[model samples]
Target chain A: MRFRYQMWTVFLAVACWGLGSVAQAAELTVSAAISLKEAFGEIAAQFEKGRPGDKINFNFAASGELSQQIERGAPVDVFASAALKQMNDLDKKGLLLAGTNQPFARNRLVVVVPKGEAKVTSFEQLSKVGRLTIGNPRTVPAGQYASEALTRAGIYNTLLASQKIVFSENVRQALAYVEDGNVDAGIVYATDARTSQKVSVGFPVPANYSEPVVYPIAVVKDSKQPDLARAFVTFVLSAQGQEILQSKGFLGANQ
Target chain B: MTDPWFSLRLSLAVATLATLVVGVLGTAAGYFLAKSRFWGKDFLDALFTLPLVLPPTVVGFYLLGLLGKRGWFGQVLFAWTGWEILFTFQAAVIAATVMAMPLMVKTARAAIESVDPAYERAAYTLGKGRWRTFFQVTLPLAWKGIAAGLVLSFARALGEFGATLMVAGNIPGKTQTMPLAIYQTTQTGEDTTALALVAILTVTSLAVLVATNRLAQGRPW
Candidate 1:
């Protein structure tokens, strides 16, 4: 009986410790789009090295989903979205700190196929493919961009009506589907295609085919560490940050 | 990119806590359901079993509605304590507990029910109180099934993903269990990391299931 009580005491102590650790230091929670995974990982490391005793925790997901989380009161310090639409919606709701929204980087939509498979080469040829995957337009900006590009090519409705389109949760998942050969082709960000050696870019959707893909970053209005969050944003927009983004196939913000 | 082992450690901690909670609550509920006969008992049983049959995403959606900041209970909690439960480690444990409850309840109920009632009758005749009779007589005989149920529940909790993701949000080193890690790694094109996580989860689940089978066969070592 004594041993059992001791075990429970230890358990409770550990649980309290876990909860307590979360409150220590200046932990900055950054909710960014899934496509920013590689670039932000490096950027966060650089930013953290410059500022000791501060940790940056990333929550990567669809920008729309992240915006929804912010609206519903997620404890986020910074929000970096893959598209302006999600940021604009949150800004309209007054969820962002005023004057904090800034365009950080840009990317283009590209069609990719399994490394050696090249039957479908262009947006118009997407309809002839057995299966085509893209992020779900409702929640993933890449999907919305891809949908617009396809609409410009006059194949979006045809692909939809023919039931040849598979909607993924995010751009990375769409890229994974193409890489895994589960789909003949997928429309994803150019940066996403570069991450996987198993998938090759088929063609870049013309910039005018859809709205220019601009990435935005801002501090959440309810951020506990607004200074730290703003600093992280500035670091991401710095020359060093732009270099990392460009190395990963992203266009500059002013492009 | 925190410690690679963070998700594994978090998952173990969450599963252990969730199983401990389920062990106590599920066993009591199981014992009560087994020994009692009441009006609307079938409805109650169905209610307890619903989580097992419903899709995990549906269960997660319901949790989000109940525990989200704007939710009824969540609104009260936030107003009173200024503490938001969503995206926390506690939320992962709660999601695991809800997901593992049905398994524990069903298995424990069957175990307790299978025990002959004559043993309880003898304990009562000897002037033993109900609580003592249950702990001394009923529990000893039903422990094997209950133990098996606990093992299965632990495994279920370890793999709980959908609900945890919905309520806990995939905060690495915090709420990212092995399953969530696997999903995230795969999506991020980190096949090597995903493969490793998948293998670890598969082996752990296999060991747990094998132990459960042994316990259920009445030959636990």
Candidate 2:
């Protein structure tokens, strides 16, 4: 009888410890696009300030890489993609929480050259450069826009045939090529181009280039913290969140 | 549809070039480390072996800084020639060489040191000079181990991804080696092509390992 009493007390003590940790704050993980790193970091800090006990972790990478991780069942609660295609694919796969998808932001594509460089002033001049870097069109949304823009401008084949084009894994890498002066010019998102001090926009691609760059976000279906995930998504779609994204050079969905 | 063998040929070229360079340089470093006793030898040994435990991306990051236009040596070269070498096949070769060098040096050093000291003493008694004795005696016995290290370095160079990606920038038909192609193809949802490339790499790596092991062990039969 005495031994049973001691065992019951120990079990209660263990249960109390687990409950105490839970009260300290549950962790919420959000996987976002590499381009969204700065914007989302600010948003997460704001979100965390409201819920003192909540801790948010972010995994940032290329949209394709992040989507592939989600497809492989990474323990992600929220996914915000820089492009609609990745979110759309996962939504079609029935892997996203129903009705939680929201179009939060958009971005424009631009061509950039290294600081103090005047060799190429416009997009049409891209064909003349020896090396013009852009993200890989197969997966990067910004690259798709650039490729389509060049095609519409009637210079895609010219650049390809001339071997004046190079590919980067993502938008920032494209910007880096121009920033480092390794390439004569590069095409990347206007937002990404702004992050570098050593590169400036040479020109903005026309709106007729490709599909509009839309950023869609949603909660993953298998989230362990569904309420928290939905709440975080709600916070991002809020007016203040849109304001922060705009400050970072992103556009409102309506724009 | 884009020549499927393009990436494979490029990979072989990079690996072969990297192996040849590392073979000569690494062997020399290994011989010195094994044969000499100097101050700070442990520190020097640690520096050479450090890459083995570091992530390839970290090595690539350092190499990028070292070879970029504003880098240490790069600033000098660019100031003189108004050009930088990043995003070229040469950059890819450099990355692979930096990454694969440690393994070759470590293995070769151990093998050279394992050569019996008694044989060297006997050669000295016969009035053979140090250089001739080393060339005739030390090198012959250590050849198999050096061969094994070279093969291993070649295989490691073939799969180099992160550093190559950082410095070389994945351009198809230009800087894209087999492993880079496999990763890019996989990301683009071309799983079949990626898997095919992976299979080719697997077979080539296995053949390299088997052939080298047989030769190194003197059991060719």
All candidates: interface RMSD: 4.2, 24.7
Candidate 1 segments whose C-alpha is farther than 4 A from its true place? A1-26, B37-43, B68-70, B78-82, B208-221
Best model number under DockQ = 1
- How does each model score on lDDT? 0.84, 0.77
CA deviation > 4 Å runs, candidate 2:
A1-25, A119-121, B1-221
lDDT of 1 by residue, B1-221 (tens): 73446676677778878988999999999998998999998898898898899988678777777777777777788899998887788888999999999999999999999999999999999999989998999888898889889888988998998778777777777667788888778777888988888888788668656755665555624
lDDT of 2 by residue, A65-136 (tens): 566556645457899998888999999999899999889898988888899988566656777887999888
How accurate is chain B of model 2, given as a TM-score from 0 to 1? 0.92
- Candidate 2 per-residue lDDT, tens place, B68-163, comes to 664677667777996556555777789889889998999889989999988888889999998888788888889888978987898888889977
lDDT of 2 at A47: 93
RMSD score of candidate 1 (Å): 3.7
Give me the candidate number with maximum TM-score. 1
